[model samples]
Target: MSAPDPVRCAVIGTKTIAGQHLPVLQTLPEAEVAALCDIDAEALGETSRRFGIERTFTSVEDLQTWGEFDAVYVLVSVLAVAEVSERFIRAGIPTFLEKPPGLYSSDTERLAEAARETGTTAMVGFNRRFYTCLQAGREALLDTGDVVSVTVHADEDAGDKWFGEKFPPEVSMRWAYANSIHALDLLRYLGGEVAKVTSVVRKRRLPKPDSFSALLEYESGAVGRAIADHFGPKGSSHWYEARTASAVLTSQARSSPGDRLSSCTLERHGREPVRFGLTGLDRRLKPGFPGESRAFLRAVQTGEPVSFPAPTLDDAVRTMKMIDEITGAEEWAPKPAS
Candidate 1:
């Protein structure tokens, strides 16, 4: 049979994250960047010109009215994700939403409901799940046996350094959901559905809860530990580990220095460890963006489900819910200056 037509894609945001997606989508054989949209005309113009995309719009309604693309990538801010992605899902277009999928688990739930009601395919862009190193490590871990335990240590500067008076209260207060979810999702991705949060320890910080440690029990009887220390002295670092009886897998953050690529290792009993890392494409574009973009476009082009590890709206809902469990909803709410 002849080659399938590329999936014409429209991007709904032109910020840093959107820039990351656009490059991969344009390079993919299965996708075409048909149009670009952003409320900020200057940013839109710059991104459109950079990518050589002629079609541009300042509103989602205008883009929908034009409706020339087969799939839409919603890379808007955390607050706008649910609203924008829901519009496309309601309009019967496949949508690729950036991580978090919404400001809260409820927001993701609403999007999931809309996708189900409209019968449109939707994916939440948990790019880390698409990391080639993580993928290989995950597979190796499973080959050894069941995943008995998984640990994720995500570190960042304090709340002031993170927000720096830039984000609105809504976004800053929900920082864990808006940002930390990227690291937190790895827990569910590796271990499985969390049955209960057995213990939680939080270091109270005024504007936001800056440190947290939680013990998780998964539905598969796996134990999980997620520790996010925003007050750490280290600038920023992340380590993800998953273990089976016979093997262990570990990876550094994708943005690690010297190569801008994650380093991963898999070790089995009585065997030398197997080491792997990201490809040049990952270094060229944002790590994991290329794979995640291809997976989303492939699903759109062929009507097949977005491959495993690329989270769907339903999966986002669970991940977000897990965030709520790890960091109580009350703590995420911003308080007025004293």
Candidate 2:
């Protein structure tokens, strides 16, 4: 059978993450980035020139007026995600939103409700959930048996300070939801929704808590634990592990520095371990971008649910709620005298 025609995608932001996603979307056989949009003309021009995207617009109103693309990728700032995405969703156009989906879970809730009310297909980009390594590890774990436990380690050196120069005070104050959700969401993607907080410890180094550790019980009867500290010497890192009765699956977040491919290993007793390394496409594009873009475009083309593991807006809402609960368990204490 012949392959389906590509979905025409119009990207709504032209900086940083959009820059990373554009090339990957172009590389997908199922997608064609037909238009680019950004309020900043210079950034839009630079991205349009860099990617050779000819159709460009300076505003969502202008893009909607043109209305030529089949799907839209809302890569706007964290604060603007809901407002921008709601327009596309309510218009009945397939919408793909970049992560954090909003500054808070409430924003995600608003988008989810809009999607349901309009019966539009909307997905949120939780790129880590699409990492090839994590996908392989998850499949292997599920094959072994029901997942009994999961452990995730997420840390960033000076994360609170890292965003100070780049984002507004509001975004900086809600740092965990804006950024750490990338790793924390993995807990739900791999294990399940956190049913209860078994225990929690939090430390505030700055205005917001900078370190957290928690034990959780999942709705699936599985147990999970996570430790997130922003005091590491390295910039950022994530480690994931999930266990079943027969095997253990572990992975280094695909975006980790110095790793060209997503590094994953599945170990089973009385059998040789299996390594789930990068595919050719992963090596060529951002580690997970090809899979992520393909998943979204596939859903747009077939009018199907997003491919397995790629989060729809509703799934992202769930992840955001979990993050809210986890980060809400913060505790403040006076610093020890040095």
Best by TM-score: 1
- Score every model by TM-score: 0.93, 0.91
What tens digits encode model 2's per-residue C-alpha lDDT throughout 190-241? 8987888644545555556777787879999999887778775676677778
Q: How would you encode candidate 1's per-residue C-alpha lDDT over 1-338 as one tens digit per residue? A: 98789999999999888877888887778888899999999999999888899999999999999988898999987778888988899988999998778887767888899988988989988888878878877887898899999998766655664557656677766777777787789998899999998546465654556677889999999999988877745655667888998888888546556422277888887899898787667867888888888888778878888757889888988888887778786554633343
Candidate 1 clashing pairs, residues 3+ apart or interchain: none
RMSD of each: 2.9, 4.6
**Candidate 2: residue 198 Cα off by (Å):** 3.8
Which pairs of residues have clashing backbones in candidate 2? Answer: none
Off by over 4 Å in 1: 158-165, 204-206, 253-261, 330-338
